[model samples]
Target: MRRPLSLFLSAVALMMTATALAAPHPVPLSELFPNSGHARSAIIINKVLERYHYRKVKLDNAFARQVLAKYLAALDPNRAFFLARDVERFENGARRLEENLRRGELDAAFDIFRVYRMRVDERVAGALKLLDGQFDFGRAESYAFPPSSASSPSTARWAQDSAELDELWRKRVKNDFLTLRLAGKADPEIRERLQKRYEGLARRIHQFNGDDVFQTFMNAYTETLEPHTSYMSPSTSENFDISMKLSLEGIGAVLRGDNEYTVVQSTVPGGPARESGQIHAGDQIVGVAQGLDGALEDVVGWRLEDVVDKIRGPKGSVVRLQLLSKSSGSTAQTREVSLVRNEIKLEDQAAKTFVVDPLANAPGLKIGVIEIPAFYRDFAAEGAGNQDFRSTTRDVRKLVEQLVAQGVDGILIDLRANGGGSLAEATSLAGLFIDTGPVVQVKDNFGKVEVETDTDPGVAYNGPLAVLVDRDSASASEIFAAAIQDYGRGLIIGEPTFGKGTVQTLIDLNRYVPGEHNDLGRLRLTMAEFFRISGGSTQLRGVEPDIRFPGADYLTNHGERSLDNALPWTQIKPADYKRVGQVSVDRLAQQSAERIAQDVGFRMLTERSKLMRDAEAQTQVSLRETERREEDKRRERAFKELQNRFLQARGITPVDEDADQIDEDALDAQRKAIARIEVDEAARILADRILMERERQPRAVMKD
Candidate 1:
C-alpha cells in the first residue's frame, strides 16, 4: 500500500513559511537521463522529510520560489555566468517547482542547468578572446571582484550585455596577468598560465554530468530549510564515510572548492599534511604535481573532485602542491609544499597531555593541559563487544587520573580547532565532570523533547577546570562545553563556538523501494535540535565563553552565524540541573582582561585581526603595476613588524624579513615554539585562577 500524502504535508506545514503560487511555464532543456529512478528518489526523500525532519516546512509556491533563488545562487553565486534575463526566466519556471516536485517532474531544474552551461561556455569564449590582445597595466580603472552571493541588480549591471561582459573579462584577465607579473613571472609565461586557467574552467563546465546537476539542485532544495541539511550523491556519500573514518590514503587534507581554486579546509590530525606542518587551512592549491619530478598541472579552475583525485595516491607516494598562502590575504603569494601520502591513524587524534609550570609571579602551581582533537569513538571495536574500546570519554578519564596523580592544581581541556565528532562521546565525556544529571536536550519533528543524562555517580577529577574553545569548535564540542558551563563545573574560555546545534540522520533511499542492486543517493536531513541544560538552543549563537579572548583573523568568516540559511537561536524550558562548582567567573574574567590589555602577544593578535578585517572589506584592486606593488609592500611590512613585536615581547630575537631560509628542522622547531606560546598563555590563566582561589581559601588547594 502507498503512503498517504497528508503525512508529508503535515510535517512540511510546521517548518515552511510560504503561500501557494500559480502554475509555472514549461521550459526547454536537453534531457540527459531517464526520469524513472530520479522520480522515485524524489518521492522517497519528500516522504522521509515529512516523517522525520525536525522542522515541518510547507512545499508551497512561495517555498518553491526560495528554492529557485537558492539553486541559482549555488550555480552562479558570483553573477559571472547567468544574466538578469536568465534569472527572470528561471524564476518563472520556479513558480511551479512545488507542483513539479509533487509530481516528480525534474525537467525545469535540468533546463536551468542547461542554460547555465551555455552561459559558461559563452563567458569562457569571451574571456579567451581578451587574452589574445594586449592589456594596459597602467590603466587607472578598478575591477570589482565582489564576494560570492553578491547578486544585487546594481552589482550585476556590469554583465548586462555581451559588450559589458567582454569588458569585465578583459579586466579579470588583466588582473590575473598583473598578479603573475608581481610574482616575478615573465609576460609569455603569465599569458600561457592565464590561458590554461580559463580553458580548464571551460573544460570543467563541459564535464558536468546529470548526477552533478541533480546533487546541486537537491542541495539547493534542502539548504532552503537549513544550511547543514544536504543530499549527497552515491560516490560523495562513500567519500564522506571514508573521511569520517580517517582511513583514506591521501595527502590527508580536506579540500573544498572556493571560487576558482581548491582550498584546504583543514588537515586530519594524524594526516601527512598536519605532521609535515607545511600545509595550513585556507591555503589555495593552484597547481598539483605527481611525484617530485612531475610537471605541474595547473588546477586553478578544475573541479574539486578532480583535484582531489590528483592529490590522492598510494601510501609512501609524494604529492607536491603550489599554494597561495592565506596569511597574505587577498593578494596571496604562492609557495610550494611537498608531502608524502600516508593513512591517518587514530592515535593522531588521541587525547595528549602537557604540564605547564607556574608563571614567574605565581610559583608552585602546576597546570595540566589536555588537547582533544575530536570526540571520537572506536565504533567497530565497541560493536564487537571489546571491553577496552577507545573512546574520548575513556581516554580522557585516564588522562584526568594521570594528571590528578601528578599533583596538578588545575586542568584545561583545549578544544581549539576541534570540529566535533561522536555525540555519544560528548555525553559520556560530560559525565566525567559531574556526578549525575541531564547533559543536553533534544527536540524532534513532533516537538517531543528528550533529555539525555549522565547516570554515573562519581566524578573523574573534581578540581579546578577550564574548557578552551574557538570558532572552529562545534557540535559535540559545543555539547560538552555547554554542559560544563551550565553546571558551573568549569570555566568556558576563548571565543564563541561554531554554533552547529542541529542533529542530522542519514537515510538510505534504496531501503524503501524494491530494486535489485540499485544505488540511490542518501539524504542527510536535520532530524533534531540541541538545547543546552539551561534552556537555550545552541543553533546560531553557539556557546558564549565565560572569559572571551580575541580570535584569529579567519574566525570572522568561519562560524554558523556566517552562513546564509542557519537556523535561528531559540530556547526551551530549563532542565532540572544544579550548579556544582564554586568558582568566581566575574573575577577570573576581570583578571584575564587586564592581562590581555598588558600582554604584547595579545595586542599584536588584535592588530593583525583588525588589518585582516579591513583587507576583507575591500572589494577593488588597482590595475596599475606600481600601485599594486606598493600595496603588497605595505602589507608585507605590517605583517613583519607585527611578528617582530611578538618575538621581542617573548624575549626571542626577531629574524629579518628577507633573512636566508631556515633549515627544515629549525623551521619545525620554530612552529612548535610559537604553538607553545599559546599553550603557555592558557596555562598562566589557569594558574591565576588557582592562585586567586587559594588566596580566598587556602584549604581549597588540593594536596596529594
Candidate 2:
C-alpha cells in the first residue's frame, strides 16, 4: 500500500532536520459571554479529568487557585495588558472557581476575560497614539520584556496604574519602531507597519467570540494538569480532525504559543518547510504573507488558530515567512523564508540509510547512519494483512542488512529531531539489535502494568550501535532509546529527550450528554504513562545519553520538564530482562570529551547555546539606536568569525557578509561546517566504540 523501501532510499543521505487581519476596518465586538453549552461542557471536562487524567488532581482550593493563576498567565503572558489591581480583583473568585466549575457555572472565567478584553483595548489604543510621536532613539534606555509561558508567568512588575501602563506601552512602541529601523526600513514604512500591526492586534482582540473564551479558559484549567491534556472547541476540533485524517496541505510544521510568539515545535518530513532547509524547531514565526506580492501580515500577538489559517492554503501556493531562528536567540535579526505549500507525503517520513564514508583520520571504520524522522507505520496496510506492509521496523530491518552488506563497522540511529510515531514499531525496532526480551513497560491509572517484548530471537545486526537523540525526540523515540540503553545493547548520545511519556485519548463531550449537539467539543485526556524496563519513568526525566554533547545542559528549561504540573519522575518494578554488557561507556566518553574540547565546531556550538541561554535570561535591551546597532553587529560579527574559522580550517575561503550572491555549494559548505559538527563527531565516537568492542574480543592466535 506504500512505496517500496528501495525507492524511498534511492537517495538515502545524511539528515539534518500566521494569518493577518484582512482590512483596517474594525469589526464591531460585543462583550463575550459563555454559550449555553459551555457550562455543561466545563462540568463534563471536570469529571473526565478527575476520573481519567494520568496526574490526578483534586478540585479543591489549591487546584482552583492554580487554574486561576494559569488562566491569567495564558491571557497576559507579557504583563503588557492587565494591571496589578485587575489580577488582585480575581483572587476571591479563584477561591470559588472549582466549586463553580462543578456546578456548571462559568461566570468567573467570563468575568476575567471581559476585564482582559478591556485592558487590551486600552493598551493597543495607547500603543497606537505613541506611534504618532517621534522617538528619541539617541537617548540611552532599554526595553524589557522577558519571555513568559503558561507554566511561568512574567516575573516583571505589573503596572500599578494607567499612567505606568501608558509608559510601558511607550517603550513597547519604541522597540517596535527600532526593530523595523534596524531591519533597514525607512521611518515612514516603520510607522505604517507598526500602525497596521498594532491595529491588527487590537482587531483580533475584539473578534474573540464565546467559543474562543471558553476554550482558552478550559485549556488554562487542563494545562495545569499536563501540557498535553487540553480542551478543543468545536471549530478547533474540526481543524484537528482534518489534520489527523488527511495530509495537511500547508507548511508541515507543528507550532505552539510561547509567550506572545508562535514558535515552531518541529517540522514534518516531506513538507515544504522541512524540504526548504530553512525553518526549524524553536524558530519564532513573526510575519507571514500569501505570495511574493501579498502584504506581509504581522502575526506577533494573533491567536494561534488565526495565524495557522493565514499560513495554510491550497497546494502549489507560495507562503513567505519572517522567522526569528531559535538558535539565533531572542534578540537576533529576523530572516525571510519562502516555501511552496504541498501535501506532506507518507514516504518522506520513512526510515532511510546513509553510509558515512570513514573520515581520513579514521579509515576502515565506516559507520552506517539511519535517519528516522518519525517511528511510522502503515496502519491500514497492516490491518489488511498486506505482507509488504510499511513500518519503521521493516524499513529499518532492510536498511540494517544493507548496511551490514556494505561492511560498515557500526550503525547510528539518528533521532535528533524525531518527535516519535508508532508504538509497535518502537518495540519491533528494538528487537532488531537485542535478543528476545521486554522492550518497554506501560502502566495505566489503576497501576496495572503491561510489558511489550521482542518475540523474535534472531538478531538483525548486533555490532556497535548507538542512538542519537535531542530534546525534540519524544514518545516512541524515548521508548526505543530507553530499551536499547536498558538492555546494554547500544549507546545513547545527544541531549535528553522530550520526556513526554504519557498517552492521550480524545473524548467527545457530546457523548456524555445524550441528545446534545456535537458542538460540545472534545477533551484530550492523558490516560496512561510509559516506564522503562529498569523501573524508571521517562515522564519528566527523559532518557539520558551515555555520552552527552556539549550543549545538553543549557536546554534544561525545555521539553516536558518545562511544563507546569508535569508528572514527576516515578518508578515501578523492574521488568525481567538480561543485560548484554557489550559497551564500555567510560573509555568512549573520555575519548569523545577530549575530541569535543579541541573541536572548533563543537566549541562554536557550545558558545551559541550559551549565548541563546544568556539572551533568554536578559530582561532588557538597549533602545539607543547607535548602541543597539553596535551591540547586534558585534554579536553577528562574532558568529561570522566562528563560521569563518571552520571554513579556514577546511581550506575554503571565508564568505563575506556583504556578498551579493553566495554559491549554493558554499552555502552547503557553510551548513556542513556548523551542522555536521555533531553528526561527524558521532561517527568518530562510533568508530572508537567499534574498536573498543574489537579489543574486548579474545585474540585469535595461530596454533602451529
Candidate 3:
C-alpha cells in the first residue's frame, strides 16, 4: 500500500499552493489627502491628551500594545476578514507603535489597513461565489451571527485547505435566502437581492479613501481611551454642526450599525419618522428606496454613512424604508413605510405641559406633567445677548408657572429618553426648583474640583415635585435629577439613568499648528468628569430611581457600563445642601412596587422582557424552513398574547386572532396607547404621593 514518493510530493505541493492562494494578498498603501502636518497634528494630539485627558494614562509600550489590539479589533471585529497571520504580522510593529506615534509615523497602521482591505476583497469574492450554488432548505444547518461564543480560527486553522470557511459563507448566504424566502420573496428575487447586497459591500470597500481610513484609525485610537471621546474628520465635523442645529431634512432618526443591519437608535420627536410612528428604536432597516416608484435597494451591508445619505433628502420629499421588525419572532417579518422629510423644529424639542386626571381611587387631585425632551439652549442667540433666547431652564420655568396657575396639585418632570445636552441648562433648570445651592461638581484631569452652584435664590414652583427619568436620561439629565434628589425636592421615578458623566472639550487640530491649510479633524477629548452633590461619580452607575419599573431589553446593551472602555464609578466629599421636601421616597416606592406586582400589564411586560433577553442571547439560528416557521409561530403567539394582556388591563378592545392586517394608523394608536399606560402609571404614583402629603398636613394648615 506504499504510495510513490513523487505522488506524495505532488499532493503536498498542491496543498501548499491552495494555502498560499487562500492567504490574502497585501494591497499597496497609497497616501491620499496627504497632510504635511500629520506629524505636527499627532504631536499636538498626544500633548493635549497627555495633559488634559481625564484618565491620565501614559502612552507607553503597554498602551501601544492595547492600541494595536484595539485597532485590529476595530478593523476586523467579527474575525471574518483578516487572517491570524496578518494579525501576527501587525503585532511585530506593536511595541514600536508608541515610538512611531510620537514621531507621527502611521506606516504600521496604514499597512494593517491595507491588508484588511485586501482580505475584505478576498472574502467578498468568495461570498459571491457561494451564491451560485443551490441551498438545501431541509438540511439541518445554522448560522452563528456575531457576538458568537465561538472563538476565531487560528493561523494554522486558516492556512489549512479545508472547505470550512467556504461552508460557513455558504451557510450565511443560505440563511439570508431563507429569511427573504419566509418574507415571501421568490428564489430569483432573493438571489438577485443578496447578490446586490454583497456587491454593495465590495463597492463600499473599494470606495474607501485615505480620509476614511485615517478617520477610522483615529477613532480607534480615541475610543481606546474612552467610549465618548472621539476624533471627528473635517467632513463629519460639518455634519455634527448640522445635527446640533436640528435643521437637517431627513426622517429625523438616529441610525447606528449593529452587526450587518442599520438599527434605529431613536427618532426625533417632531421628525417625519416619529410623526409617522412607523419606525421604532431597535428596528432594523434592511432596504431603502427613493420616492413612491423607486426600486428597493438592499442596504444590509452598506456603510452607515452611505445608508444615512440615502435616507436624507430635501424637505417635503418622500423616502421609503423596508424594515425588519425587532419585535417579530423571526427576521423574515418586514414592513414598508414611506415618510415625508421635514425640518426638526425647535418647538418640537421645547418643554411642554399637560394635565393628567387623578388616579382611579383618588379622584380630586390633578397632576401636571412637563415633558423635557433635551436640556437644550440657543447658545448662538444667548451669546449675542438676546434676552429672549430659548433654553430648557427658561422654558421649563414658564411651564411650571403655567401649571401652578392652572391649580395643579402636583407636578411631574418627565425626562424619559431625554439624552442630556447643555450642562448650563441643567444647572439653571435645577435652580428653578431649589433656592440656591451647589448643583453639580466637576473634577478635571489634574484633580482640581470645582463646584457648579445655582446662584438664583428664587424657587419657581416647589409643590410636591417629582422628576421621572429612564435609562436614556443622561449627563445633564443626571445632574439635574441628582441635585433635585439630594435636596429632597422631588421623587426620582422610572428606570436608572444612562451613566455618561464625563465632560468632553473639542480641540480644533488646525489651531494647534498655524499655516497648515489641511483640514485637520477636531478631537472630542474627555477632560473632566461630573459628580452629583452627594459625591458619587455618575460615570458607570447612573442615578438610581426611587421607584423601579419592569426591566427593558434595551438596557442590556445601551448603558455606559456596557461599553468596554467606560470610566469607573467613584465618590468624593458630599456637597452641603439642605433637604426642603417632606416626601418619603421609600414609602412611595413600596406602594408603587405593590401596585406594579398586582398590575397585569406590568406582569406581561416583565414576561415579554425576559423572552426578549432570551432571544437576544441565542447566537445560532436554524436554516431549516420548517423549524424556522415553527419558531416564528411560537414567537408570534407569545407577542400577541402579551399584547392582549396589555389591552385587557387597559379595558381596550383586544386585537382579534385572525385580524393580522391592521392599518398603520391602528398600529400607531396601539403604540401610543401602550405609552400612555406607562404615563398613567407614573401619574398614579404621583397621585399616591399627593394623597400621602395631604394626610400628613394638619387640618388647620390644609384649610389655610
Candidate 4:
C-alpha cells in the first residue's frame, strides 16, 4: 500500500548495496567496528519498537542469541566458511551480541566477521590451487548443493577442522567445473572463469565497508522481532523511494540476494519483465548480458547491486538474463530472455479485460476476465486533483461496465500474481462489488481497531463474481479477496494468499539522533497488523480460498508461514456486516473438481508440478561424467514427452527433439495456449457457479 505509516513497505526484500568499486582498498577486519552514531541508533530503534511496534518483544540475552544466529546465517548461509568450532566460539559469547550492539560495543561481532573473512581467504587460495590439479570426472562423488541431508555433501558442509573445510571447497570447485562443462564451455575457458570467480569472491568480501556490516547486524536485530521489519542502508533506502514513485528504469523486477545468486522475487506490474511472460518469481539469474550481442557475464557470485546495475539501462535498451526456473525440475538447465528496459507505466499496468468466448466469438454467453497485475493507484495524479487518476477501482469499474455492455454472464477478477498495493484502492474496489459494507479491519500496536467500510452504494457486475488468487497475492490483494469471501459476494477459487498483513513504516535514523550525527540508514519497522472484517488477522495465515484448487500447493513453503518470526494469527472483535450467502461454494467446488480431474491441461500441469518438486528435492548430483550424462538424457526425454503431450492435446504440431532454437512467436503462442487452458478452466468454474446461482435469477450458460 501507500506509505500510510511514516513505514514505506509494499515490496518485500531490499538488499544492502556495496560501495562503488573504485579499486578495492583492503579494509582491515580489525577496523570494521560500529561507527560513531550506531549506539544511539540502536537505543533509539529499541524505543521506537517499544512505543509503536505491534509485537512487544524483549531484547534480552535469549533475543541476543537469536540475533547472533541470524547474523551468522546472513553472512554465511550455507553453513560454509566457518567451522563448527568457530560457531561454538561465537555461541559462547552470543548473549553479549545484543548487549554489545545496544551499547555500541561491536568489537566481538567484528572479531567473528574477521574469522569468517580469514576462512574465505583460505578457501579461495586452496580452490585456486585445486584448479591446476588434475580432476577425475569419473570419480563416484557428488557435491551437496546448499548443504542439505540429501546425499550430496556429507555433514551438511559444517566442518570440524580445516581439512574438512578443504574437502568441502574442493567439492564446491568440482561442482562449479561440472556445471560449466555441462553448459558446453571448454576446459580452458572454464579454468579462466573459475579462477576469476574464486578470486573475485575474496575481493568482494574484502570490499565490505562498515555500513554493510552495520546494516546486516541491524537487520538481524529487527527481523528477529518480525520478518517484515528491516534496517535499510542509505543507498538501499533509495530503492524504496524509487519503487514507491515508480521511477525505476530497468527490467522492472524486484530482486533479492539469495546466497550467491540474485533471485527474481517479484516483477513490477507493466514492467518489461512481467510483460515478457517468460521470467517468473523463484527464477534464479545466473548470468546477465547487455543488449543482444553483448558477451554474457557470469553473475552467480557477483554482488546483488552489481548484478542489478548490469540488468538496468537506458529505456529501450536490451538486457539479457539467463534464468534457472524453479519449474525446470531435474534438468536444471538455464533459459535466456532478452527484455527491453523501460519504466513502469501506470497505464500499461492498469486493469485490462478480455472475453473468454467458448463459442469462438459467436453470439453466446462469455466470461469476462479482468487481470490485475497489482492493486495500484496513482497517488501523485490523485493529489493533483485529477478525477481521471489511475487506480484499480476506477479501471476495474470501467472494465466491469464494458463487460456488462458486452453481455457477459459472469466476471473473474484474475489476481494470480498481484502482490498488493493501495489500501484505499482495495476498500473502494470492494465497494464496487457490494452496495455497502465493512471491507477490512486495522488493529494498531495499541488495542484500538478500526473498520474500513465501503460507503458507496453502487454495484458493478455483481452477478456470479469470483476471485482467482495465487500464493503471491498479498496485503491489499488479501484484503479485497477476504472481503469478497466474507460478504458471500464471490468465490475465492485458487491458492491461499501470501500472508503479509503487518504494516511497516519507514523512519529516518537521522531524525532520531541529535545534531552532528552520521547519516544513519532508515528502519522499515512493523507498526500495525491487519485483521479481516470477520475477525481473523491476515498476518501469518493468509486468506484461504473457499475452493482451493488441486495445484494450490504448487509453491510449498512459499508463504507467510515460511517466514521466521512472523506475527501469529489471532482474532479480534468482528465487524457488524451481513453476509449475502449467494455462493453455494460446496456445490460449485464438487462440480469443478470432477471436471479438473479429467481435463488434459490441468492433469499435465499437476504431473509437471510433481516433477518439479522431485527435482527440487534433489540436493545431490553424480560427479561421474557417464552417470551425469545418463541422468541429463533421462530428464531431457521426460521433458520432451511432456511437451509433445501438451502440444498434441492442444492440436499443435510438435517440434523435433533435436531442434536447438524456437522462434519467439512460436514460444509466445505456446505460452498463450497453455495459459488459456487454466483461464478456460477458471471460466468453467465460474460458469458452474453462475448456472447454480441462476435458480435465484436466470442467466445464459457457457457451451463447449
Candidate with top TM-score is 2
User: Which sections of candidate 4 miss by over 4 Å?
Assistant: 2-24, 147-157, 238-246, 329-331, 359-364, 654-661, 695-704
Question: Which consecutive 10 residues in model 1 have the weakest lDDT in total?
Answer: 1-10
Give me the overall lDDT of model 4. 0.76
lDDT digits (tens) for residues 1-704 of candidate 3: 10111111221221111111132232235644435455566667787788888997588888887777667666665566766567778888666888888877777877787777777778788877877878899988788765521111121233222255566677778888899988889998998898889877777776766667777777777767776677767766765555444444567776766557777766665677777767876688999998998999999977676677677767777789999766563444677888887766667789988988756746988889999988888887889999999989889988988988989988989988777778889999999989999999999899989999999988998688888888778778889988888888888888888788888777898887788787777888888889988899888888987777876433575557656578899988988877787557787778777888787777666776666566656678999999998888788777778778787666676644235576655566667676665566788888888888888778864553
lDDT string, candidate 2, 1-704, tens digits: 01111111111100111222354333344547776799989989998888888777799988888888889888888788888888888986666887888987888888898888778888888888888888999997898875556567646767798888887888888988888788777999888888888787777877777888898999888877777788888976765555455544677777777877887767777777777777777788889988887888888887776667677777778889988866655456778887888766678889888877856547877989999998888888879989898888999999999999989888999988887778888999999999999999999877789999999998998788989998888889999999999888888999999898887777899998998865899887778889999999988889999989989978857877877778889999999999986566898889899988988888788878876677667678888888878877888878778877877887777755345676767666666566667878888888887777678789999898
Output the lDDT of residue 578, model 1: 94
Best by lDDT: 2
lDDT of each: 0.75, 0.79, 0.74, 0.76
Clash count per candidate: 8, 1, 0, 4
Q: What TM-score goes with each of the models? A: 0.90, 0.93, 0.89, 0.92
How close to the true structure is residue 169 of candidate 1, measured as C-alpha lDDT?
Answer: 75
The candidate with the higher lDDT, 1 or 4, is 4
TM-score of 1: 0.90
* lDDT tens digits by residue: candidate 1, 454-487: 9989999888889988776888899999999999
Clashing pairs in 2: 19-307
Worst 10 residues of 4 by lDDT: 10-19
Query: Judged by TM-score relative to the true structure, which candidate is superior, 2 or 3?
Result: 2
